[model samples]
Target: MSVTDILRLGPVMPVLVIDAVEHAVPLARALVAGGVRVLEVTLRTPVAFDAVRAIRAAVPDAVVGVGTLTRPDDVAAARAAGAAFGVSPGAYPALLAAAAQAGLPLLPGTMTPSDVMTVRAAGYTACKLFPAAQAGGVGMLKAMHGPFPDQLFCPTGGIDAASAPGFLALPNVACVGGSWLAPKALVQAGDWPAITALAQAASALRA
Candidate 1:
């Protein structure tokens, strides 16, 4: 399925960073069991690609995407590791072009209306709002909707289960990206049950 379809399926997309490859499958299974299918595994660790590969190998139903993409080669590396899609904290023309060339659906980050307009001009109908809270949260996204109704957003950074529903309620917000559900401490502890509960709670949010 397409990245947009996958992302729009839920109110929140679990932003995960798997330090141990073994946790990938169980974590994915837990999320899926709790009503989440789309997962963004950020390349913040050395085993990120292996984790992505392991998740894909084990969970055929999960729609996995790569995050923390900053360079063009990062995109290439993710595709090589079998990412279904890619997300960047910020936009770069070379990275965008490379993503298109690789046929990898991308969610480039934008912080302002001008950033939004720039991506729109580049033919991207959807984008990511990084550091969502610090970047103005739902209010900032709402402000842009009037001028760019066609654009969709996946607001990332500082979002948690408590604040997710509000952002998802915005007309422009497709889904929220957050690491709260898969907290580093919990994941490090191999607390799949806790993650599952978090996912279930997050999935209860309405757009």
Candidate 2:
């Protein structure tokens, strides 16, 4: 799917950090059970690629994506691991080039107007607002809509269930990225039902 189509899959895309590859499939299943199909598994752990592979192999309904992409190699690696898309914390020359070369759909992150411009020049109308709260949250997005009316954002970082509706309410926001849906305590304890409940609530945030 295109990045825009992926963002429209659900109101909240869980930003997952999987430490154990074993939990990947079940975690993906739980989220999909709650009506969330787009998942962003961050490349913060040693088993990240393995987790992505496991999810892709086991979960046909989940559109698994790789997040926290910082290197040129990560783009190729993510595509090889079966990621449907990729997200980066920031947009850079090399990473952007690598994504184009590999033909990977990317949601490059941005925090400033200049970053948005750079991403736009690279042929992306959809992007992520990294560190959303620190970047002024709703206010920043509102300000940006005037200058970048054609752009849409998936604001990640420092967002939670309580604040997600506010972000989703914005016309410029396609969705929001957060970790609250798969709390570490819940995941570590194998509490898939609770995660599913969280996902259900998050999935309702937009509609």
lDDT agreement with native, every candidate: 0.88, 0.96
Error of 2 at 184 (Å): 0.7
Compute the lDDT of residue 79 as modeled in candidate 2.
Answer: 93
TM-score list, all predictions: 0.96, 0.99
In the range 1-207, model 1's lDDT, one tens digit per residue, is 566676788989889988888889999998988888899999898999999999899998888999999999998999998999999988868988988898888888999888887777778888999889999998998888888998999999988878888898888888999988888888788888998898889888962
User: Which regions of candidate 2 deviate over 4 angstroms?
Assistant: none
Model 2, C-alpha of 97: deviation from truth (Å): 1.0
Identify the runs in model 1 with alpha carbons over 4 angstroms from their true place: none
Estimate the TM-score for candidate 2.
0.99
Full-model lDDT, candidate 1: 0.88
Q: For residues 1-207, what per-residue lDDT tens digits would candidate 2 score against the true structure?
A: 799999999999999999999899999999999999999999999999999999998999999999999999999999999899999999998999999999899999999999999999999999999999999999999999999999999999999999998999999999999999998999999999999999999999888
